[model samples]
Target: MTTITAGRLREAAELLGIRNQATLNEIRARYSERVKEWHPDVSQNDPAESHEMTIRLKEAYDLLTDYCMNRPVSFRLEDLEKDLEQSPADYWMERFGDDPIWG
Candidate 1:
């Protein structure tokens, strides 16, 4: 798997309407709220933002998943797969079982 750059992750957050670094719970809560608000069904009045929000949501999720999986020092390979299955976009199994130090 490729290394995840902080710049790319930050960019994803910005696209997802996230203005600051956040915990996993914070990311999930905020992402859900934004998705609900911008869902095409909910935001019929603004199709443009809705479409953009969809793409942004995916990016944000991927970045958050990658970041999270790459953190824990004792991360496990099976856990990575579980994470991916539970939240594929944010799972990032590849990064977890790689080098001892991602840096």
Candidate 2:
């Protein structure tokens, strides 16, 4: 029973394109495909890039699978979408206050 944080879960989902209430099967399938695509044996034998991709792929898969198995079906996607929408505006404002982009 590994303890997982919301941020980690979100990061994994983003990495694996698991947005908008995607299913566990989708997560596993996508992650498996990505791993295959980025696997060291298949990535032109570039050890450095392969290692990095492998690490990222493993992290994303582990987090997503953990979340998928543990989280309830009642989990809501609307809250995450709203948060993403607001985060960008808040970030832009902080970077450049009263910008025309807000209009």
* Backbone clash count, each prediction separately: 0, 0
TM-score of 1: 0.56
Query: Which tens-of-lDDT digit does each residue in 1-103 have in candidate 1?
Result: 6568888888778766678657778788878887887788878657887887777787678778778876866459988666557564333455454557652
User: Candidate 1's C-alpha lDDT?
Assistant: 0.73
Candidate 2 has a TM-score of 0.59
Please estimate how well model 2 matches the true structure, expressed as its whole-model Cα lDDT.
0.77
- How close to the true structure is residue 71 of candidate 2, measured as C-alpha lDDT? 67
TM-score of each: 0.56, 0.59
Off by more than 4 A, model 2:
1-3, 73-103
Summarize candidate 2's per-residue lDDT along 1-103 as a digit string, tens digits: 6568888788788877677556778888888888888888888768898889889988888877776786665436986676567676677677677768664
- The Cα RMSD in angstroms, rounded to one decimal, for candidate 2 relative to the true structure is 7.7
